[model samples]
Target: MPEQPQWSERTLDMPPQDPWADQPTAPGTVPTPPPPADPAPFSRGRAQVNPQPHHTQRYAEHEPTGIGWPGAEAPGAPHGMTWRWSELRRGSEWTTAAVLFAFVCWGIWALSGGGPLGTPLIVFAVTLAVAVGVFCLARVVGYVVLERQFGRRRRTARGSHLVTALFLAGVGVADLQQTQWVMDAYHWVAGQIS
Candidate 1:
């Protein structure tokens, strides 16, 4: 049989008082009973605990998102290789396209007046038509495609369309001002020649 292990020798000694017991009773040392709890965060009248302000107003309708806006988790947005039309406008696509088209048309019109086939004017006209047509097509296509893919309209977040329109108008004004300066210079040169 295995021998039983011997228990420790017994000794009598009083347990020391807790060191913190005599510390001057902290103010409000009496524990505050936690306020009676309610199952819900808010309640009214008697027995109410942890009441939160009530909100009864409704929110305006907002567009849903799938790629860029809140609650979007598109596989083709800003991360992976999935063809998305919205990606085009993400990198100044429309703005750049508009500017380029304007530049090309202006160049052709300024370099050569309307004439036969292959003339600068003819080229300018063709390009102008294509650019305008394509831009219109792209705008429609972009809204459709992104709407389908993201489940949300591709409009800007806040006064987006208005802001963009205003910006375009400002740009047009600046361009017209420059054109006026150029035409004045041309007139001055012509006057000198005459």
Candidate 2:
């Protein structure tokens, strides 16, 4: 007869109990509230402010002319003009730079045998046109509205974003196989302008 197999007893070890387990504690272990603030010490330097009407700033009867600073605001600027003029101006500049760079990249890609009307080129031009157009249109609208709403330079504040948007959109149209039309329109417009 084969010998019977032997088995040993098995047991599982439990995890350690948490130190913060619910248990009764001595009253001394409870936290105490902070003492009240001292009256005399807290009252120091808390006196009421005294406002004076005469202390307000006074503007000159006549407006300042450039304030001796070159390229500063000319003799005429709309009242209530805030600092946002600078913001719109800078944003328009960056939009112009991005559109220019996209055009350069598109030209280089086409010259490298990425056929001008190929799917990739069309996609590139159209996508770039849409993106640049949206950004520049927003920029143009912003400065125009800003000037109308704030500064007095509404006539002179037209940004480069308008031209950039038109140029980018024209490239996209050209990519759709209408290059001759774009060139003709461009020449006609140039002739009219000149």
Candidate 3:
């Protein structure tokens, strides 16, 4: 018969008990509470609800202006004007740029072996360029004429949240259009080169 396994002498090792097990301790292990805060000083008179006014003006009053700077609010009436010329210009610029980029993309797409839209693409691009350009020119004329008529401080302000939102939206659309335009152009060019 085979030799009997050494089960009689072997034993399994068990894990050690946790130090924090629920056992009674012989030493002190309690925590202490922190000191309390001092009481506020009391005034004897009747309290007035009206608080002192602060000197700081609105943060928007001090924003800067420019072309590449994105959104800059245009100057208007002395108090608070609804439309700022600068903001309009910025919006127009964003629109124009997006349209132009799209047009160029279309042109590129046409040049490639794309389809029957080559001539149409070119026409569309030209029309977009002219329309946007005219709109920009009209804005310039309108601003100059209005400024000449209305007298006061012509200071330009930085863009507001609304203007920024408009710009970002336009840019987002342009970016999406770019993907399609670029892909089509690439295929067209590739087909031609090969």
Candidate 4:
């Protein structure tokens, strides 16, 4: 059998290696070279525990200032008339459509002999007042329901206005058919306009 190689002779043939070869050394021992300075200008690994607010956020906290109404003044109006008009103006288009629909319906009803014959003008005016009041109440209820179910950002559905207008038109047409006087007046007006 051949003789085995000795462990001492194998160690003698290799050069000595240092354990701290990867660590950096300071030149002339000057404050350890300031810890070899961070390789990157910003730390990419760590996350920000406390972040700063954006610049625009500071300005957004302030309330806006401007004229409430332009080119409109109430010289002898009531105390709350301007505020009431502002509220009315700010109402949604759907509410306006509903109020208009109510007026149209009231006119048709009045023209179709819906009120007392003794005092026709008074009856018509009363009917109109009641119709408008009911319609305004209904609009307020609708807005409240929508705001409660959805958020305040919700708007009236387009289909609702279409449906309401179509129904009122149908009612008006039926009422107009029953009233010969209104039909005659309408025809006379159309002929004069043409």
Candidate 5:
């Protein structure tokens, strides 16, 4: 027969293993997680315990001072009767530059005999007509849909339709005359160049 295994009384009475038993601790102290960091003054999640009145006053004092609509003012315009160049330059510097460059290139190409003057002239006429149509459509939509349905009044729309119509009619007459002027100018430049 195999020899019987010896079992000590201390081993028999001992409790099961505790994972945290080896960790150092004071006689009566317990371990705790670290305290959280202080929240920022304007953090999203944290509430403002003490809101500053001066900040609100400062923001209220700064009123918005420029035309709200894009392209509402002429290029290189001053602040009087239109948006200043500084205001228009914000977020639109590249776009403004690109449009001016395109116009310059188009003028050079037209003068260089890229195609018959009629092609670009007719295209410009059609573009002007479409622009006027879209402008009128927008006015109608603003007055009927936005103002009536949404109860948001666009005060400018009241007389803007008449003004825009008159302006577009004048532009149409000018556009018709512009073709002859452009052709004359292009020929004059071509004569000087050759």
Candidate 6:
């Protein structure tokens, strides 16, 4: 290895001279070094720990590494690959197929052909449609407001949302059969438009 250069022989910038260099110091006084830059940001002065951990004794010894321990992503997502209309086309197709099947079931009931099985099939299809629609809408719009406001950490746990959606869907289907709320809402919207 090449020999290191002496400080006198090296090219170096001059250190700033102390303004108080001319002042006489108190006998045996030691000058203090500058305080370190903050470790974690946005913090006030720290409290003393009674028993500091051995590992943390050399707190600033290691260089920072921002990586986390690797593992499988937590199961269901908003994890990788944002779902767009193109990605959701397959789901749209399935929904369309389900709706058609429900229509066919309704027609069979209307014609008075398939009596016992007809109503059950229509109910089942509508339920499936509601469940699938809830999930699709969630996937599409869940992140829009959430990601803007709170990032990934602030996402509301989806289990409650799913449960609430399912309950509403059940109520909607019941209202569809008994109350004709869709017709009422359509007329209400038309009145508002007019």
User: Candidate 3: where are CA atoms >4 Å away?
Assistant: 1-89, 92-115, 152-194
Full candidate order by TM-score, most accurate first = 4, 6, 5, 1, 2, 3
- Count backbone clashes in candidate 4: 0
Q: Please give the range of 10 consecutive residues that has the lowest summed lDDT in model 5.
A: 74-83
For model 3, what is the C-alpha lDDT against the true structure? 0.51
TM-score of 1: 0.26
Model 6, range 1-194, lDDT digits (tens) per residue? 99999988887775557752444446798756546755654456786779955774643343334443335333222454355444445335444544555455444334443347666667666766676667656664655545433445233335324543455545444545443455577679999999
Estimate every model's Cα lDDT from 0 to 1.
0.50, 0.56, 0.51, 0.51, 0.51, 0.52
Q: 1 or 6, which is superior by TM-score?
A: 6
What are the C-alpha RMSDs, in order, of all predicted structures? 16.2, 25.2, 24.8, 16.0, 18.7, 18.3
Model 4: colliding residue pairs: none
Question: Model 3, residue 192: what's the lDDT?
Answer: 100
Instruction: Give lDDT: candidate 3, residue 176.
Output: 46
Off by over 4 Å in 4: 1-84, 90-118, 153-175, 181-194
Best by TM-score: 4
Which segments of model 6 are wrong by more than 4 Å? 1-115, 154-160, 163-194
Q: Which stretches of candidate 1 lie over 4 Å from their true place?
A: 1-118, 156-194
Clashes of each: 0, 0, 1, 0, 0, 0
Candidate 1 per-residue lDDT over residues 73-153, each given as its tens digit: 654443232345554445454455455645554654454443454564564466546544554555555555665566554
lDDT of 2: 0.56
lDDT of 5 by residue, 20-135 (tens): 34555568898765467466355546655896566534333333436335434433333222234553334343333433443454455456555688886675556456645754
Pairs clashing within candidate 3: 71-159
**Over the stretch 9-58, how does candidate 4's per-residue lDDT look in tens digits?**
66665333664244444567544334665566656577768877667555
* Model 5 misplaced stretches (Cα beyond 4 Å): 1-113, 157-194
| lDDT for predicted candidate 5 compared with the true structure | 0.51
